[model samples]
Target: MLKEKGLLGNIGVQVVIAMCVGTLVGAMMGHSASMFAPLGSIFIHLIKMLVIPLVAVAIISGAAGLGSSHSAGKVGFATLGFFGFTSAVAVALALFMGEVFQPGMGVDLTGVEGLFSNVYADKGDLPSFWATVLGMIPTNVFQSLNEANILQILVFCLFFGIALSKLEKDRRDPLINGVNAIVDAMVWMINVVMKIAPLGVFGLMADAVGTFGFSALMVVFKLFLVYVGAILIYGFVFYPLMIKVFSKTSPVKFLSVMKKPQAVALSTASSMATLPVTMEACEEELGVKNSTASFVLPLGATINMSGNAIYYGLVAIFFAQMFNIDLGMSAYLAIIVTSTLGAVGQAGVPGPSFLVVAVLLSAGIPIEGLPLLFALDRIFDMIRTALNITGDAACAVIINDMVSKDPSHAAEEKVQNA
Candidate 1:
């Protein structure tokens, strides 16, 4: 859109500049830098206003489009399979890196021991399998919408979208068109909002840095370093490989176009808040089908949290090493399973990942040192959130390619040609 405006016109470039300046300003001003926070808050609220409705309408439109085809069920399964597989791989990689680096060993906890707390101990109990399933099925759809309950919203929209697709074309087309119109309107609004993203990003970065300086990081610097390396490996190495093998996209181009969404993800640290940018990046820049992107991206944002899986696994191992607890083969398996599942169960919003608590508890790791990490969770959350959105886009691109190449699609095109 800003092609005529040169390099600085690009949203991604602007955000990066804003972020760097914000960081310097924050470091200089310290806590007082929070004065710019309203810019960030206003921008986040604007994005939040659009997210629930956009997700609902977009998914319904996507599902209906796919449901009209023979590949709906295939698309659904493939997306879920991709999320599960990537998440499992992420956890395993984190575990491997943790064991190799041993970020938790030789930690002088003398002064920092006071930061440990049992406040989060009670939050570690994971819901039963059946309960988690049941919770996804909302008893009140409107209430779910009001609360912005993403999983429940996804459940209803997918079901409703598929049902809409079953109607006669004369009936379905009008509703689908109406839904598409809403999506287009939302997209336009998002574009308008994005013009101010640089200012908003500046506010967010300044506030985060000013409030939580680099001092807290010194305590667990090794753990933080390892965490970032895992994210980079996953984002730059693993996802690019997946795209190269499974889709037509070049890894370079995909990464290039992704800078905008990744910047927003870093600043917001909430996949849900960054949903609009991710969707636009996939559909416009990556050439993913709206039918594929709308369905897959939102679902990915809600549940496909391979980034969090890595964090949970690494943190579990870190604490295990710190406390001198020997993790057996069973414990490793538990960490893998728990971390993967826990990552999926987490909400996409920015917050302290108490799910890490569950992962630690599952592997018999200590949770006492968790508060130390929590203090620096913002930085950790920002890095991982960027990776999370990248995973979502990769799955969308790969799945779109799969659907296009399906035999059923080929036959259907031939039938139309005839």
Candidate 2:
């Protein structure tokens, strides 16, 4: 609806306009627009820099912080279940839409010579399934970081963070503080890089449209519908049912309290950056106890990426369509599973699509197809980020009710204790 409604004035639309202008200018300039490619690489590099370290410290910080707490295992499990459930539904929904819509079917790839990097450049000895399992736990963390082995980094952080979490507070505080500082530093850098997004998006768009022309953009525009539609359905239909089925909270009431943080998330496109408001909404506005809010909201931001799950799912399948790669039933299953699990590892950055789309690498899509996706990202990012934050708040409400010994008595106790 970004194309139709257009009232929200989201940054995505502004970037979309910039892309359009870039296309027109590039069409006029013709071959000279080739210069924009390297300029566009600046944005891609920024995204890479943001995602790698961001995912690393986010996992570590989340693990160490949760480890420092004494949250009930029941609450933790329930929150995890909520995120996984919503994420599965979201991806499935997107996969269905992509199949039905075939949004990328008519997109032209002609003249896109060398636009995509050879995805198989890093293809190693295809591991036996067991070796693949072992591979995720790296022998050297620094080596994993250097290689940008996201899967390995995720596994290592899990263990390190869990170990750090179990240490006594006297020993744990320093590590936790250090992790926070690293994450903050990365955030600052990302903020600086984002200032160039408009120019970067323009260059990327100019190159893409000049190569493929306006006719192909119809396909991406339609694909954006798939992304945004899945988000809307999940937010309005899936979550409303979740609220009703899981607890007695009025869906309207729950959604109403979330408006402030949801707005913040929509504007910023960084759930981690919007954490303070989300936490406040969960605790003060929605009446979740601080004990539950403290653990669930933070963990949800780090790991609960239902929105990213859907975007990447649709994208993986879309690109597979573009390149004429048929992912069989098993690969379809892989997309769902990988995307869901990948969401857990997705960095809570301003533009997280780059990280999430790596899930498609498992399906054998070329990494070169990514710039096209990146050019169209901001429009989709706004919607997905809102879904991510809403999923977090909704889980807090649902799990707050779930973890209480007596749902009816819990509210009374909360008020009395407060």
| Candidate 1 lDDT over residue span 1-418, tens digit each | 2222243236557766887888788889999999988887888788788778878887898889888789888999999999999999999999999999999999877666677788888988888899999999999999999998988999999999999999998999999999989987886776666668788878877886677665645668899999999999999999999999999999999999888788778766778767777888898889998888888988898899999999999999888988999999999999998988898888787767888988999988878888888546766887899999999999999999998899998797688689
Deviating ranges (above 4 Å) for candidate 2 = 1-71, 110-114, 119-219, 352-358, 406-418
Question: What is the RMSD, in Å, between candidate 1 and the native fold over all Cα?
Answer: 2.7
Q: How close is candidate 2 to the true structure, as a TM-score?
A: 0.66
For each candidate in turn, the TM-score is 0.90, 0.66
- What's model 2's overall lDDT? 0.71
lDDT tens digits by residue: candidate 2, 219-318: 4787887788888888888887788898768899887776666655654566665665676677776788665665676677777999999997889878
CA lDDT of each prediction against the hidden true structure: 0.86, 0.71
Candidate 1 wrongly placed segments (more than 4 Å): 1-40, 110-114, 196-213, 415-418
Q: Could you tell me how far off, in angstroms, the CA of residue 66 lies in candidate 1 after the best superposition?
A: 0.7
Error of 1 at 277 (Å): 3.3
